[model samples]
Target: MGVDQNSIWNLHNKLPSFPTLNKNEQTEVLIVGGGITGLLTAYELINIGLKVMVIDASTLCSGTTGRTTAKISAQHGILYDSIIQSSGVEQARQYYTAAMDGKDRILNILEELKMDIDIEQKDSVIYTEYDENIQAIEDEFRAYDTLNIPGKYTETTELPVETKAAVTMFHQAQFDPLLYIKQIIDVSIKQGLEVYEHTQAIDIEHGNEIKVTTDKGHEIHCTYVVQATHFPFFDPLGMFTTRLIPERSFIYAGKNENPHLKGMHLSNDTPARSIRTAKINNEHAILIGGEGYVVGKNKSSADPYKQLKQTAYTLFPDHTFISQWSAQDYNTMDSIPYIGRLKNKYENIFVATGFKKWGMTTSATAAVLIKDLIQKRQNPNENLFSPSRFELTSSVPTFVKQNSHVATQLIKGKVSDEGKSIDELKANDATTLFKKGKKLGVYKDEQEVVHVVDTTCTHLGCEVEWNTYDLTWDCPCHGSRYTYTGKVIEGPAKKHLKKEEL
Candidate 1:
């Protein structure tokens, strides 16, 4: 069965279109992303009477924000146990507190605005059906208990499948992010917030005042800047490229009659599967998500989505498939997000990133924490999530391993150019070839047209791989994605891939 690549966000109202920054502008705070994180930060600051402006390289919600599974829970897959092991019990407790604060913030906004947004209060559970995995689940529950995090371990859950053990955090939530983000953008606009879509922030100039240079040759002058973009585009001294590791996960949603699944669920088993229920046209539906892999690992696939369907049908016999989408999330060297000043020197520049696929809760947390930092308010969670806080014990190994993988990918990308000759290439597909040792990416459009671009990623000097599913050339090194025709789609790379002559 052919499935379309649309996410299941049925937005009822048309969102306002923002313009490009054709001329220079100034604001008190310049937020350099338009996703959930950037917009939420704008809403938070603007409500407090700050002159804020947000800018995005592409259109709003066109990135990973549009493709989320919408799980608004802090149950980050047996996280507390690991957090306690890596950091301490206190740090684990702090993490949990911050996540709860984020969840409460979302609900508070919903209540204050009286917006429907299709939110539901459901228990978030992490369970394992395998006997070998039951111990880990038990340990996670114990960690929850030790931290006084109200959760329970049980053999039975709302899952249709059998579970040996499950850890449940009751009253966690899920909602349509598209709906919530629209309200965030709209409400912020009402408070004199300015947003520019399709305006990529290529570079930033540091001084007493921050000057953000855009692709359109216009600048945004502000006292402070926030790198709320998914992968920050401008990182000169932060070493973010070496520290951030990107992974992609796929999610499929299907129609169901009176969905049997009630609570948001994630399996602790190997090759995890997450299940949740949502409203589609006011009717019940189930979303099956999992099958995660490193960004450049799946250049060629034997169809993971079909495998997901097999798993879904085996568990829930009543599901009728409708739509599927994928999201890319970054993991920090440590598990926590970076949600404060970017650096000691660049104190005026703040950042919010590394959500680890749990952005639904963490994004709101980042927004509020950023507001506190900007206003110089005493926030309890401020130092806990700082960008420069380095946990060397936990982060060093991951940093080494992540960058080693990157170095290997960079080497492999430069060497592996064994694509079919132009005669064998097909329409709506892409491949990389070399001429005179210059690597070139080639694509054939549906209209029988040819396009080519330099296959090197503009962010770092790594080569790119073709993604047949998305019809783009994706960088395996730092998760920079480009259209088959060479336009930048996602970044740590702000510049477009150089177009090549056919």
Candidate 2:
């Protein structure tokens, strides 16, 4: 029963917490999240003598940063071909350069600080098993050639699975993400980076100055703000929630003294699997990940860990399962991330999100681009990642299709009333019940105590379904999630669910 809680990074790194926001604060720049993007942005700003403040609803490095597979590579799983087809060859080159720059920046910082953070360079590969995906792999190789990227296609790989073809990008890397982030945080603190943890940013009021209101009734006034909370908590631009598609992917680790490969590898076929190496308990281990589906797509609320267990065992039968975890990410209509001004009119407000699952390098790319924009420097890559750069023919149809799917989910949520009664549920079980014209999500603990909460999502009023594996209420519409006891765990939901006595 390994689950999302058992990430290998969490076992090795623990971040110290900061006091919650207690009083009104003012700063030149405010970063509303303390994940990798926010921290890196703070690091960059503080070094340039700008007064920067970073606040996290939880502790630093406690969000998606702690949950990633930690692959630091420019090779984002057969992406160049699609980018070239969608944007152009020049834009594809820029995207490739941006990814490499992100990797190089991290390497340079690590070398300058001389942090022993278990960093190692290796080739990244996107391989395939099915014959149908071979042309896609070949097309990716052709795109690499057009972009002058240092990569090659091969028929064989070091993986235990029989990959028919693969494309490899050299000089890529993997590292302990928390360890790398911790060094920047330490340096940022010394450089006067004000970091507050356990402080939830509820909403932002726009006037002459942006007022970021916290759940504790304190407001942070800042000339500039970056919403780097995976999903934008406050979307005045109204573009994020509509364009971003929330997805959840699973990761599992196991003990293996001798594992398959020295590099990061991803399968291009269906039920895609990614493999990389990690150090666990002074022994070698292999991390197998990737079984991504949009949040709330599963009707059974099926645990991804079951399929992951089968994948791990089938690939590395000698290894013993150690941990399992899941991470959430947002995908844009296009594959590129939105990393600059939230709107064309608002120069002071910025946001960085829609990283898809390739966040290790994209996060750094975002930090650098956002920093350039705040300093009023012209970033060449801005147009490539612009939030407003919508392709009428390409993106409009996708936008409409995504919203149509959402409407379908909303309609389904309104009509469906199909859960066992709360009295019939057993301990350690959850069920959604329609009682007296009210939809209630009830979960009974091992101690036979029942916890009940209103099942409507606070973000868009979508009816929330019980996730049995993770013990949370998940939204089918926009992927907002909540704890069984009605606490908000993820967004675009900013408010906790209504509580009810059981």
Best candidate (score: TM-score): 2
- TM-scores, each model vs. reference: 0.95, 0.96
Runs off by more than 4 Å, candidate 2: 1-4, 280-282, 299-303
Tell me model 2's lDDT, rounded to 2 decimals. Answer: 0.84
lDDT of each: 0.84, 0.84
Q: What is the lDDT of residue 77 in candidate 2?
A: 78
How big is the positional error of residue 337 in model 2, measured in Å on the Cα after superposition? 0.7
* Backbone clash count, each prediction separately: 0, 2
Candidate 2 versus truth, CA RMSD in Å, comes to 1.8
Q: What is the C-alpha RMSD of each candidate to the true structure, in Å?
A: 2.1, 1.8
lDDT of 1 by residue, 1-502 (tens): 1113677873333457898889999999999888889988888998889999988887787778888888999898788999999889999999999999899999999988888667889889998889999999989999999999888999978766788999999779998788888888777888799988889887888887889999889988999898999887767775588888888888878788887566888998767898888875677777888888778876445566776787778777888987777778998888788788877568888888888899989999999999999999988888888878877888898888888989998889888885588889877767778888889998888887999999989888899887766677888888988877788877688788999975
Residue 82's lDDT in candidate 1: 90
